[model samples]
Target: MPSTEITDDTFIRRYADDIAYVAQQPPATDLATLAAQLDTVAPRYEAAGITGHEDLETASLHLDEALRATGTDRDAFLRRAHNLLRPLVADMTQEYRLAAGD
Candidate 1:
């Protein structure tokens, strides 16, 4: 039988790249804009089978806080967001490579 898998390109794959790009934005980049962008992503994540451990939500939360924060506090929030997101980029890239090999 042919494979029944839904090969529909996953949101996680797209999301990984999106967050990676956002993470690389300069400190002057607008936090509110990125927060809005990430909000648009949340609805799709659950349906895409993104698990709780992925914790993309926390990254968004940090961005939201960063927008409200200032000085060292804002920097801290952005740093946390970057730390949270960059690993997902690597993890999703690895998963994509493995799936391609399969």
Candidate 2:
């Protein structure tokens, strides 16, 4: 994803890389299981309407708590970060597509 006026290019690139890394990370602990465990995290977004990137860290925090409750803490942070990045990839890709006048 490319940078926008609100954030730097390096940050966006790092986010992308981190997302990929988290997706690939071996979950030695259940805290890292984003997919199966997100059921617990989904409610926080439901209450807040899951708007934008501004909510990522906050949402991640909630997810971390949920993971900790599930008996693992290793990958909670990265898992949340990965969840945050998925939407960003879509949003940024669409922005680039629109810029291309598609």
**Candidate that would win on lDDT:** 1
TM-score of each: 0.55, 0.29
Deviation from native of the Cα of residue 45 in model 2, angstroms = 20
Instruction: Quote the lDDT for 28 in model 1.
Output: 25
Model 1 bad stretches (over 4 Å) = 1-29, 52-54, 90-102
lDDT of each: 0.53, 0.42
Q: Least lDDT summed over 10 consecutive residues: which range in candidate 2? A: 3-12
User: How much lDDT does candidate 1 score?
Assistant: 0.53
For model 1, how does the per-residue alpha-carbon lDDT over 1-102 read when each residue is reduced to its tens digit?
Answer: 852221113223334445434344322234565555565544444454554334567877987887788787876777676667656745543443454462
The true-structure Cα RMSD of candidate 1 reads 13.9
- Candidate 2 lDDT, tens digit per residue, 1-102? 942321223323444333333234432233334332333323433343444535454545654565455433434444455556556535543443454465
